[model samples]
Target: MKKLSFLFIIFILIHSSVSAIDRRTEQFSTEFGYLTLPLPYVIPGAGMGLGFLGGFNNVPFGST
Candidate 1:
């Protein structure tokens, strides 16, 4: 389950392309602050609850 999700994220990053319309592409930069909050585990192995909660409050210093 975790492996599948990791692969999916990797695939997205690999295939992701940037296209700016009005030169305001900074708003679309990939951020890692709270991006991990909303993962649904289809196959629960162990400690899944704690994992999701841990992602909520981990705001980085330069999070935009």
Candidate 2:
């Protein structure tokens, strides 16, 4: 019970200290450019081609 009370006091003190800090900023910049392309359709096609090549190489009867 004593340990629990000590932990509760520590928690309250830490919580109060954290609440006292101020975090407000008013200066910022937003100038950026990026390029993105779809991959879900591209990756599966590439993976299938790679897997077919691997299977062909492993099995002598297989061909691509």
How well does each candidate superpose onto the true structure, as a TM-score? 0.26, 0.31
Question: Pick by TM-score: which candidate is best?
Answer: 2
What's the C-alpha lDDT at position 60 in model 1? 59
State the weakest 10-residue window (summed lDDT) of model 2. 48-57
Model 2 quality (TM-score) = 0.31
lDDT for each residue of candidate 2 in 13-40, tens digit (9 for 90 to 100): 9999888556586344233334454434
Query: What is the Å distance of residue 23 in model 1 from its true position?
Result: 13
The models' CA-based lDDT, in order, is 0.59, 0.55
